[model samples]
Target: MHLNNDHLISLAETFKLLGDPTRLAILVACLEQEKTVGQIVSDTGASQSLVSHHLRLLRGARLIQPRRDGRHIYYHAHDQHIRCTLQDMIEHIQEEER
Candidate 1:
Protein backbone atom coordinates (compact mmCIF):
# COMPACT_ATOMS: atom_id res chain seq x y z
CA MET A 1 0.00 0.00 0.00
CA HIS A 2 1.18 3.48 -0.81
CA LEU A 3 1.35 5.92 2.09
CA ASN A 4 0.98 9.63 1.74
CA ASN A 5 3.43 12.00 3.40
CA ASP A 6 1.22 12.41 6.47
CA HIS A 7 0.76 8.66 6.82
CA LEU A 8 4.47 8.12 6.36
CA ILE A 9 5.19 10.69 9.05
CA SER A 10 2.83 8.89 11.39
CA LEU A 11 4.49 5.59 10.63
CA ALA A 12 7.85 7.18 11.36
CA GLU A 13 6.55 8.35 14.71
CA THR A 14 5.38 4.82 15.48
CA PHE A 15 8.80 3.42 14.65
CA LYS A 16 10.41 6.27 16.58
CA LEU A 17 8.35 5.23 19.56
CA LEU A 18 10.08 1.88 19.43
CA GLY A 19 13.46 3.52 18.88
CA ASP A 20 13.88 4.16 22.59
CA PRO A 21 15.34 1.21 24.47
CA THR A 22 13.15 1.89 27.48
CA ARG A 23 10.00 1.92 25.39
CA LEU A 24 11.10 -1.23 23.59
CA ALA A 25 11.73 -2.94 26.90
CA ILE A 26 8.36 -1.79 28.16
CA LEU A 27 6.69 -3.20 25.07
CA VAL A 28 8.47 -6.52 25.58
CA ALA A 29 7.43 -6.58 29.20
CA CYS A 30 3.81 -5.94 28.32
CA LEU A 31 3.92 -8.71 25.76
CA GLU A 32 4.20 -11.26 28.56
CA GLN A 33 1.57 -9.66 30.80
CA GLU A 34 -0.56 -6.55 31.01
CA LYS A 35 0.86 -4.27 33.66
CA THR A 36 0.00 -1.24 35.72
CA VAL A 37 2.37 1.76 35.84
CA GLY A 38 3.65 0.56 39.18
CA GLN A 39 4.25 -2.89 37.82
CA ILE A 40 6.15 -1.44 34.90
CA VAL A 41 8.39 0.52 37.24
CA SER A 42 9.11 -2.52 39.35
CA ASP A 43 9.82 -4.72 36.39
CA THR A 44 11.88 -2.22 34.40
CA GLY A 45 13.76 -0.64 37.31
CA ALA A 46 12.86 2.75 35.91
CA SER A 47 11.38 5.48 38.03
CA GLN A 48 7.59 5.58 38.03
CA SER A 49 7.53 9.06 36.50
CA LEU A 50 9.94 8.09 33.73
CA VAL A 51 7.91 5.00 32.91
CA SER A 52 4.74 7.07 32.89
CA HIS A 53 6.35 9.49 30.45
CA HIS A 54 7.22 6.72 28.01
CA LEU A 55 3.79 5.18 28.45
CA ARG A 56 2.19 8.45 27.44
CA LEU A 57 4.30 8.62 24.29
CA LEU A 58 3.43 5.00 23.41
CA ARG A 59 -0.26 5.67 24.00
CA GLY A 60 -0.09 8.80 21.86
CA ALA A 61 1.42 6.77 19.02
CA ARG A 62 -1.40 4.20 19.36
CA LEU A 63 1.11 1.43 20.04
CA ILE A 64 -0.47 0.70 23.41
CA GLN A 65 -3.76 1.22 25.21
CA PRO A 66 -4.52 1.94 28.81
CA ARG A 67 -7.53 0.62 30.65
CA ARG A 68 -8.62 2.24 33.85
CA ASP A 69 -9.30 0.04 36.85
CA GLY A 70 -10.40 2.34 39.66
CA ARG A 71 -7.42 4.61 40.32
CA HIS A 72 -4.99 2.35 38.53
CA ILE A 73 -4.34 2.26 34.81
CA TYR A 74 -3.25 -0.98 33.14
CA TYR A 75 -1.39 -0.74 29.85
CA HIS A 76 -1.32 -3.36 27.12
CA ALA A 77 -0.77 -3.63 23.39
CA HIS A 78 -3.86 -2.37 21.56
CA ASP A 79 -3.53 -5.31 19.15
CA GLN A 80 -1.14 -7.86 17.78
CA HIS A 81 -0.11 -5.60 14.90
CA ILE A 82 2.50 -3.82 16.97
CA ARG A 83 3.92 -7.11 18.25
CA CYS A 84 4.03 -8.64 14.79
CA THR A 85 5.60 -5.52 13.32
CA LEU A 86 8.22 -5.52 16.05
CA GLN A 87 9.04 -9.17 15.47
CA ASP A 88 9.39 -8.62 11.76
CA MET A 89 11.54 -5.54 12.29
CA ILE A 90 13.83 -7.47 14.62
CA GLU A 91 14.22 -10.32 12.14
CA HIS A 92 15.01 -7.87 9.38
CA ILE A 93 17.56 -6.08 11.54
CA GLN A 94 19.24 -9.37 12.48
CA GLU A 95 19.41 -10.38 8.84
CA GLU A 96 21.00 -7.05 7.93
CA GLU A 97 23.58 -7.48 10.69
CA ARG A 98 24.50 -10.91 9.32
Candidate 2:
Protein backbone atom coordinates (compact mmCIF):
# COMPACT_ATOMS: atom_id res chain seq x y z
CA MET A 1 0.00 0.00 0.00
CA HIS A 2 1.10 3.55 -0.60
CA LEU A 3 1.70 5.56 2.56
CA ASN A 4 2.31 9.27 2.53
CA ASN A 5 4.89 10.91 4.79
CA ASP A 6 2.37 11.55 7.58
CA HIS A 7 1.18 8.00 7.37
CA LEU A 8 4.74 6.73 7.54
CA ILE A 9 5.49 8.91 10.53
CA SER A 10 2.39 7.74 12.34
CA LEU A 11 3.23 4.14 11.54
CA ALA A 12 6.71 4.61 12.97
CA GLU A 13 5.29 6.16 16.11
CA THR A 14 2.97 3.19 16.47
CA PHE A 15 5.90 0.82 16.17
CA LYS A 16 7.74 2.81 18.83
CA LEU A 17 4.77 2.40 21.14
CA LEU A 18 4.62 -1.33 20.51
CA GLY A 19 8.34 -1.62 21.21
CA ASP A 20 7.67 -1.30 24.94
CA PRO A 21 7.35 -4.67 26.62
CA THR A 22 5.06 -3.41 29.37
CA ARG A 23 2.70 -1.69 27.02
CA LEU A 24 2.77 -4.67 24.69
CA ALA A 25 1.86 -6.95 27.59
CA ILE A 26 -1.02 -4.70 28.48
CA LEU A 27 -2.27 -4.81 24.94
CA VAL A 28 -2.04 -8.59 24.83
CA ALA A 29 -4.05 -8.77 28.04
CA CYS A 30 -6.86 -6.85 26.39
CA LEU A 31 -6.75 -8.70 23.08
CA GLU A 32 -9.56 -11.12 23.64
CA GLN A 33 -11.70 -9.27 26.15
CA GLU A 34 -12.35 -5.91 27.71
CA LYS A 35 -10.65 -5.35 31.03
CA THR A 36 -10.68 -2.76 33.76
CA VAL A 37 -7.51 -1.27 35.19
CA GLY A 38 -7.51 -3.71 38.08
CA GLN A 39 -7.99 -6.65 35.75
CA ILE A 40 -5.12 -5.47 33.60
CA VAL A 41 -2.88 -5.22 36.66
CA SER A 42 -3.86 -8.71 37.67
CA ASP A 43 -3.26 -10.09 34.22
CA THR A 44 0.13 -8.44 33.72
CA GLY A 45 1.32 -8.16 37.34
CA ALA A 46 1.97 -4.50 36.80
CA SER A 47 1.16 -1.87 39.37
CA GLN A 48 -2.06 0.07 39.03
CA SER A 49 -0.07 3.25 38.69
CA LEU A 50 2.09 1.76 35.99
CA VAL A 51 -0.87 0.25 34.17
CA SER A 52 -2.72 3.53 34.29
CA HIS A 53 0.28 5.32 32.88
CA HIS A 54 0.63 2.88 30.00
CA LEU A 55 -3.09 2.98 29.36
CA ARG A 56 -2.91 6.70 28.82
CA LEU A 57 -0.17 6.33 26.27
CA LEU A 58 -1.95 3.44 24.58
CA ARG A 59 -5.19 5.37 24.44
CA GLY A 60 -3.45 8.38 22.95
CA ALA A 61 -1.91 6.14 20.33
CA ARG A 62 -5.35 4.71 19.51
CA LEU A 63 -4.00 1.23 20.08
CA ILE A 64 -6.60 0.60 22.73
CA GLN A 65 -9.95 2.11 23.60
CA PRO A 66 -11.73 2.76 26.89
CA ARG A 67 -15.32 2.23 27.79
CA ARG A 68 -17.07 3.30 30.97
CA ASP A 69 -19.54 1.20 32.84
CA GLY A 70 -20.63 3.37 35.73
CA ARG A 71 -17.62 4.18 37.89
CA HIS A 72 -15.37 1.63 36.27
CA ILE A 73 -13.65 1.95 32.93
CA TYR A 74 -13.01 -1.03 30.67
CA TYR A 75 -10.27 -1.18 28.07
CA HIS A 76 -9.96 -3.38 25.04
CA ALA A 77 -8.04 -3.70 21.83
CA HIS A 78 -9.04 -0.65 19.87
CA ASP A 79 -10.43 -2.30 16.74
CA GLN A 80 -10.02 -5.11 14.27
CA HIS A 81 -7.06 -3.39 12.65
CA ILE A 82 -5.02 -3.28 15.83
CA ARG A 83 -6.21 -6.64 17.08
CA CYS A 84 -5.43 -8.33 13.79
CA THR A 85 -2.12 -6.58 13.40
CA LEU A 86 -0.97 -7.76 16.80
CA GLN A 87 -2.25 -11.26 16.31
CA ASP A 88 -0.68 -11.48 12.91
CA MET A 89 2.68 -10.35 14.22
CA ILE A 90 2.60 -12.95 16.94
CA GLU A 91 1.79 -15.58 14.37
CA HIS A 92 4.63 -14.42 12.22
CA ILE A 93 7.11 -14.99 15.03
CA GLN A 94 5.57 -18.30 16.00
CA GLU A 95 5.87 -19.38 12.39
CA GLU A 96 9.59 -18.60 12.42
CA GLU A 97 10.06 -20.85 15.42
CA ARG A 98 8.45 -23.77 13.69
Candidate 3:
Protein backbone atom coordinates (compact mmCIF):
# COMPACT_ATOMS: atom_id res chain seq x y z
CA MET A 1 0.00 0.00 0.00
CA HIS A 2 1.18 3.48 -0.77
CA LEU A 3 1.35 6.16 1.88
CA ASN A 4 -0.03 9.63 1.27
CA ASN A 5 2.30 12.63 0.86
CA ASP A 6 1.47 14.02 4.30
CA HIS A 7 2.14 10.66 5.93
CA LEU A 8 5.43 10.37 4.07
CA ILE A 9 6.42 13.85 5.15
CA SER A 10 5.57 13.09 8.77
CA LEU A 11 7.58 9.86 8.67
CA ALA A 12 10.50 11.73 7.16
CA GLU A 13 10.29 14.37 9.88
CA THR A 14 10.17 11.73 12.57
CA PHE A 15 13.28 10.15 11.09
CA LYS A 16 15.00 13.49 10.93
CA LEU A 17 14.08 14.30 14.53
CA LEU A 18 15.37 10.95 15.78
CA GLY A 19 18.52 11.02 13.66
CA ASP A 20 20.37 13.38 16.01
CA PRO A 21 21.73 12.06 19.30
CA THR A 22 21.22 15.43 20.96
CA ARG A 23 17.55 15.53 20.10
CA LEU A 24 17.07 12.04 21.49
CA ALA A 25 18.97 12.98 24.62
CA ILE A 26 16.91 16.11 25.09
CA LEU A 27 13.71 14.11 24.89
CA VAL A 28 15.02 11.61 27.39
CA ALA A 29 16.04 14.36 29.75
CA CYS A 30 12.67 16.03 29.50
CA LEU A 31 11.10 12.68 30.29
CA GLU A 32 13.10 12.61 33.50
CA GLN A 33 11.95 16.06 34.63
CA GLU A 34 10.70 19.41 33.44
CA LYS A 35 13.82 21.52 33.05
CA THR A 36 15.03 24.89 32.00
CA VAL A 37 17.56 25.29 29.21
CA GLY A 38 20.39 25.55 31.71
CA GLN A 39 19.22 22.45 33.52
CA ILE A 40 19.01 20.56 30.24
CA VAL A 41 22.56 21.51 29.42
CA SER A 42 23.72 20.15 32.75
CA ASP A 43 21.77 16.93 32.40
CA THR A 44 22.83 16.20 28.82
CA GLY A 45 26.38 17.52 29.24
CA ALA A 46 25.90 19.36 25.96
CA SER A 47 26.57 23.01 25.22
CA GLN A 48 23.79 25.52 25.90
CA SER A 49 23.57 26.29 22.21
CA LEU A 50 23.35 22.61 21.32
CA VAL A 51 20.66 21.93 23.90
CA SER A 52 18.65 24.92 22.74
CA HIS A 53 18.98 23.80 19.14
CA HIS A 54 17.70 20.31 19.91
CA LEU A 55 14.95 21.72 22.09
CA ARG A 56 13.84 23.85 19.17
CA LEU A 57 13.52 20.81 16.92
CA LEU A 58 11.70 18.77 19.55
CA ARG A 59 9.37 21.68 20.27
CA GLY A 60 8.75 22.12 16.55
CA ALA A 61 7.80 18.46 16.32
CA ARG A 62 5.31 18.83 19.21
CA LEU A 63 7.22 16.15 21.08
CA ILE A 64 7.81 18.48 24.01
CA GLN A 65 6.33 21.60 25.62
CA PRO A 66 7.67 24.60 27.44
CA ARG A 67 6.47 26.42 30.53
CA ARG A 68 7.46 29.96 31.26
CA ASP A 69 8.30 31.16 34.75
CA GLY A 70 9.34 34.76 35.16
CA ARG A 71 12.28 35.12 32.80
CA HIS A 72 13.06 31.42 32.50
CA ILE A 73 11.47 28.83 30.27
CA TYR A 74 11.12 25.22 31.35
CA TYR A 75 10.51 22.25 29.11
CA HIS A 76 8.98 18.85 29.55
CA ALA A 77 7.63 15.99 27.48
CA HIS A 78 4.34 16.96 25.88
CA ASP A 79 2.69 13.80 27.07
CA GLN A 80 3.20 10.20 28.10
CA HIS A 81 2.62 9.14 24.51
CA ILE A 82 6.15 10.13 23.47
CA ARG A 83 7.73 8.56 26.52
CA CYS A 84 5.84 5.36 25.89
CA THR A 85 6.75 5.46 22.24
CA LEU A 86 10.42 5.84 23.06
CA GLN A 87 10.25 2.99 25.54
CA ASP A 88 8.52 0.82 22.96
CA MET A 89 11.22 1.59 20.43
CA ILE A 90 13.89 0.64 22.95
CA GLU A 91 12.16 -2.62 23.72
CA HIS A 92 11.83 -3.41 20.02
CA ILE A 93 15.57 -2.91 19.56
CA GLN A 94 16.43 -5.00 22.60
CA GLU A 95 14.20 -7.79 21.39
CA GLU A 96 16.04 -7.81 18.09
CA GLU A 97 19.38 -7.93 19.89
CA ARG A 98 18.39 -10.80 22.11
Candidate 4:
Protein backbone atom coordinates (compact mmCIF):
# COMPACT_ATOMS: atom_id res chain seq x y z
CA MET A 1 0.00 0.00 0.00
CA HIS A 2 1.60 3.20 -1.16
CA LEU A 3 0.65 6.17 1.01
CA ASN A 4 0.62 9.49 -0.75
CA ASN A 5 1.73 12.69 0.98
CA ASP A 6 -1.69 13.53 2.35
CA HIS A 7 -2.24 10.05 3.70
CA LEU A 8 1.22 10.00 5.21
CA ILE A 9 0.63 13.34 6.90
CA SER A 10 -2.68 12.22 8.29
CA LEU A 11 -1.14 9.01 9.59
CA ALA A 12 1.61 10.96 11.26
CA GLU A 13 -0.89 13.35 12.82
CA THR A 14 -2.87 10.43 14.20
CA PHE A 15 0.21 9.05 15.87
CA LYS A 16 1.07 12.44 17.25
CA LEU A 17 -2.35 12.67 18.82
CA LEU A 18 -2.01 9.21 20.30
CA GLY A 19 1.42 10.04 21.66
CA ASP A 20 -0.08 12.12 24.48
CA PRO A 21 -0.53 10.09 27.66
CA THR A 22 -3.65 11.95 28.76
CA ARG A 23 -5.32 11.49 25.38
CA LEU A 24 -4.32 7.83 25.28
CA ALA A 25 -5.80 7.35 28.74
CA ILE A 26 -8.99 9.06 27.65
CA LEU A 27 -9.27 6.69 24.68
CA VAL A 28 -8.56 3.67 26.89
CA ALA A 29 -11.23 4.81 29.32
CA CYS A 30 -13.73 4.69 26.48
CA LEU A 31 -12.62 1.30 25.24
CA GLU A 32 -15.12 -0.82 27.11
CA GLN A 33 -17.99 1.62 27.40
CA GLU A 34 -19.04 5.22 26.96
CA LYS A 35 -18.11 7.64 29.72
CA THR A 36 -18.94 11.15 30.74
CA VAL A 37 -16.18 13.71 31.16
CA GLY A 38 -16.53 13.49 34.92
CA GLN A 39 -16.22 9.72 34.78
CA ILE A 40 -13.07 9.99 32.73
CA VAL A 41 -11.66 12.54 35.12
CA SER A 42 -12.30 10.24 38.07
CA ASP A 43 -10.94 7.17 36.30
CA THR A 44 -7.81 8.86 34.99
CA GLY A 45 -7.16 11.00 38.08
CA ALA A 46 -6.74 13.91 35.71
CA SER A 47 -8.17 17.36 36.10
CA GLN A 48 -11.58 18.01 34.60
CA SER A 49 -10.22 20.72 32.33
CA LEU A 50 -7.39 18.50 31.10
CA VAL A 51 -9.72 15.61 30.36
CA SER A 52 -12.12 17.91 28.56
CA HIS A 53 -9.30 19.31 26.48
CA HIS A 54 -8.11 15.90 25.37
CA LEU A 55 -11.68 14.76 24.74
CA ARG A 56 -12.13 17.63 22.30
CA LEU A 57 -8.96 16.66 20.50
CA LEU A 58 -9.98 12.98 20.33
CA ARG A 59 -13.42 13.87 19.07
CA GLY A 60 -11.91 16.13 16.42
CA ALA A 61 -9.64 13.30 15.35
CA ARG A 62 -12.70 11.06 14.92
CA LEU A 63 -11.14 8.54 17.27
CA ILE A 64 -14.09 8.94 19.61
CA GLN A 65 -17.76 9.82 19.32
CA PRO A 66 -19.86 11.87 21.68
CA ARG A 67 -23.57 11.63 22.32
CA ARG A 68 -25.60 14.11 24.25
CA ASP A 69 -28.16 12.94 26.73
CA GLY A 70 -29.83 15.89 28.33
CA ARG A 71 -26.99 17.99 29.73
CA HIS A 72 -24.46 15.16 29.86
CA ILE A 73 -22.21 14.10 27.03
CA TYR A 74 -21.08 10.50 26.78
CA TYR A 75 -18.04 9.45 24.80
CA HIS A 76 -16.97 6.11 23.37
CA ALA A 77 -14.51 4.69 20.90
CA HIS A 78 -15.80 5.65 17.48
CA ASP A 79 -14.99 2.27 15.90
CA GLN A 80 -13.70 -1.21 16.53
CA HIS A 81 -10.38 -0.36 14.91
CA ILE A 82 -9.60 2.03 17.73
CA ARG A 83 -10.66 -0.44 20.39
CA CYS A 84 -8.62 -3.24 18.85
CA THR A 85 -5.56 -1.06 18.37
CA LEU A 86 -5.60 0.05 22.00
CA GLN A 87 -6.30 -3.46 23.24
CA ASP A 88 -3.41 -4.82 21.21
CA MET A 89 -1.10 -2.16 22.58
CA ILE A 90 -2.19 -2.90 26.14
CA GLU A 91 -1.57 -6.60 25.68
CA HIS A 92 1.82 -5.95 24.13
CA ILE A 93 2.80 -3.75 27.06
CA GLN A 94 1.65 -6.37 29.56
CA GLU A 95 3.77 -8.94 27.79
CA GLU A 96 6.77 -6.67 27.97
CA GLU A 97 6.34 -6.33 31.74
CA ARG A 98 6.86 -10.06 32.13
Give the alpha carbon lDDT tens digit for every residue of 44-82 in model 4: 999999998999899898999999999999999999999
lDDT of 2 by residue, 10-48 (tens): 999999999999999999999999999999999999999
Residue 19 deviation, candidate 1, in Å?
Answer: 0.9
Candidate 3 lDDT, tens digit per residue, 1-98? 89999999998998789888888888888886789998889988999998988888888889989999999999998888888998788789899888
Estimate TM-scores for all models.
0.83, 0.95, 0.83, 0.94
What residue runs in model 4 are displaced by over 4 Å at the alpha carbon?
none
Model 2: which ten-residue window has the lowest total lDDT? 88-97
The number of clashing residue pairs in model 4 is: 0
Task: Give the residue spans of candidate 2 off by over 4 A.
Answer: none
- For candidate 2, list the clashing residue pairs, or say none: none
Whole-structure CA lDDT of model 3: 0.88
RMSD (CA, Å), candidate 4 to true, equals 0.9
Give each model's whole-structure lDDT: 0.85, 0.97, 0.88, 0.94
Q: Sort by lDDT, best first: what order?
A: 2, 4, 3, 1
Ranking by TM-score: 2, 4, 1, 3
**Tens digits of lDDT, candidate 1, 8-94:** 999888877788999988887787468998899888898989998999888888888898989888998778988787778778889
